[model samples]
Target chain A: MKNKSIELMKRYRFFAIMIVVTLAILVVKPDMGVRVYSLAFNSVFEMLGVLPPIFILIGLLDVWVKKETMVKYMGKDSGIIGVLLGFFLGSAAAGPLYGAFPVAGVFLNKGSRLANVFIIVGAWASMKIPLLLFEVAAMGWQFTLIRLVMDIFGVLVIAYSMEKILNDDDERQIYELARKMSQ
Target chain B: MIMTIIFYGLAVIGLVFSFVKSREKTKMALMKALKAFENILPQFLGIVLLIGVILSILSPQQISQLIGENSGWVGVVIATVIGSITLIPGFLAFPLAAALLENGAGYMQIGAFVSSLMMVGIVTMPVEVLYFGKKATLLRNGMGLVFSILVAMVIGGIMS
Candidate 1:
C-alpha cells in the first residue's frame, strides 16, 4: 500500500501540477488560461500521435539486441572499436532523450558499463540517423549531411568526455543481473 | 484486417522467438513502450509548441527581415545562430524552413537554421545536464553551436 501510493504520486505529479496551475491561471484570467491550456494540450496530443510506430520498432528490437553484442563491442575497455560500436548502436536506436534513459538504465543492469551506456544514450537523444534520411529527402541532401556530421561529431565529443568524467555509481546489482541473465 | 494480421504475425514471430529463447517478457514489453514514448511523442509536441509560439509571436516577415535579409552568406549565419538557440522540433523544422525559403529566405539559411535548431538547443540544456552532467553538456553544446554554424556556412556556400 505504501509503495502503491508513492508510485501513484510519482506518476501523477506532473499531471497534478498541471491541473493546479491551470486552475490558478483560470482564476486569475479565465478565458486566456483555458486558451493556453487547450493549446498546450492539443500540442501534447499531437506529439503523442508519433508514439505507435516507434513502439513497434522497439518491440522488434526487444527480440533482437543481444548481451554478447553489447559486451564484446560496447564494453568499457574496448577502445575506438567500442566507441564506434556504441555510436552505431546508439544512432540506430530510435527515440528521444527520455526513451534512451530507461534503456541506458537497463544497459547498466545488464552489465554494460556506465561509459558505453552514456555514449549510447547520448546518441539516442542527439543523433537521429534514420530521420535524417527523410529530412534530406524533404529538405536537401547537403542540409541533412551537414547536420548529421555535426551531430555525430558532437556525440563523439560529449561521449568521450563523459567516459572521462562520470564516476561509476551503479550498485552491485549489475553482477547480480548479469548472473541471472546468463542463467 | 491485413495490417492487423501482419502486426500479429510480426508480434507472434517476435514473441515466439523471445519466449523460445527464454527472454524476459515483462522487460521486453516495458522496453518497447518506453522507447516509443520517448522518441516520437516528445519530439512532436516539443516541436509544435516551440514553433507555434515562435511563429505566433514573430511573423515570417519579421524573421525574414532579421535573419533572412542576405541570400549571400550573412543571412545564413544569423539564421543558423538563431535556430541553434531556439531548438525547433525536427519534423516541423523542415516545413517551416520550407515556408521561410519560399518567402525570400535563402535555402542555405533555411538549411543551416534547421540544422542548428536540432543540434544546438538551450532549452534542452537542463535535461542534457541532468543526464550527461553539466560540463559535458556545456562543452558539447558549445561545440555543437560552432559546428552548426560551420555546417550552415558550408551548405550555404555549396548552394549559393
Candidate 2:
C-alpha cells in the first residue's frame, strides 16, 4: 500500500509542484492570483466539456476498429487513401491537439504509416473543421480561406518531410514507442 | 456549441451501438478510456495551471501591443514565440486573435500567432515527448514552427 502510494505521488509530482507555485502566486500577488484561479477554472471546464467524448470515441475506435482494417487503410502501401483518411479523421475530431496524440499513438500501434499518422496530427492541429468555422466567423473568409489552403499544403509537406527525414532505426523506435503507449 | 453537441451525439450513438453489439466489449472500451484519461491526468493538470499563469500574465491589450501593426517583422517573431509557448484552445484563441486584430495588430502577426498556437506546442512538449520520444517530438515541433512562419508570411503578403 505504501509503495503504491509512493508511486502515485511520483506520477503526480509535476502537478503537485504546479499547485505549490500557483499558491505562491496567490500569496504574493492576490489580484493576478484571482485571475489565475478563474482562468484555470474556465480551462478545466472547457477540458471536461471536450475530453470525455473524445476519449470515448478513441476507446470505441480501439475496440471496434480492427488492426487489419486500420492497416489496410493506413499502412505502408495504403498511399493517398490513407492520407485522405487521416485528414478526414483529424478534421472531424473535436478538442485540443494534445487529444490527438493518443489517437495517433493508436494509429501507429495499429500499423499506420508514419506519414499518415503525421498527416492526422497536422490536420488535427491546424485544419479542424469546426474550428475553421469559428475562424471564418472571427477572422473572415478571406483570411480563413488563405490560411486553410496554405495549411493543407503545409500539413502534407510536413508529414512527408518528417517521414523522409527519419531513418529506419528511428522509425522502428517510434513504432515501438507507440506500441508501448497504446498498451 | 454545435460542435459540442455533435461530439456528444456521436459518442452516445457509438456507445449505444457498441453496447448492443457486445456489452463486454463496450465495458472494456469504457475501462480503456478511463485508464487513458487517468494516465494523462497529471500532465493535464499541469498544463491547465501553466495556461492559467500564462494567460493571466499576458492580457489581450498587452498581446496586441506586442504585435501591433507598427511592430513589423519583430512583431511576427514575438507572436510566433508566444504562440509556440502557449497552448490556448481554438475557441478562446480565435476570439483573442480577432480582438487583437481590432486593436490594430497586423494580419501577419496574428497569422503567426494563430498558426503557431495550433501547430507548435512548447508547453505541451512534455506530453508529446512521452508518446513520440524526444527526437521525433523536437523535429515535429521544429517543423511546425517553420511552417507557421511560412503561413504568417503568406497571409501577410496576400491579406495586407
Best by DockQ: 2
- After superposing candidate 2 on the true structure, give the runs of residues whose Cα lies further than 4 Å from its correct spot: A1-7
Pairs in steric clash, model 1: A96-B39
Per-residue lDDT of B1-160 in model 2, one digit per residue for the tens? 6777888899999999999999999999998788778777888898889889998998888999999998998999999999998878898899999999999999999999999999999888777876788888899999999999999999999988
Q: For residues A61-154, write the lDDT of model 2, one tens digit per residue.
A: 8899999999999999898899999999989888889988888888998889999999999999999999999999999999999989999999
Q: Candidate 1, TM-score vs. the true structure? A: 0.64
Docking class of 1: incorrect
Each candidate: RMSD: 6.4, 1.4
Runs with alpha carbons beyond 4 Å of true place in candidate 1: A1-39, A46-69, A79-81, A93-98, A108-127, A165-183, B1-16, B19-24, B27-65, B71-88, B106-112, B125-130, B133-135
State how far residue A42 of model 1 sits from its true place (Å): 5.0
Residue-level lDDT of model 1, residues B50-131, one tens digit each, is 4334444454567767666365567777786677556444555566776777777876677667666755666455444433
Q: Once model 1 is optimally superposed onto the true structure by TM-score, how far is the C-alpha of residue A171 displaced, in angstroms?
A: 13
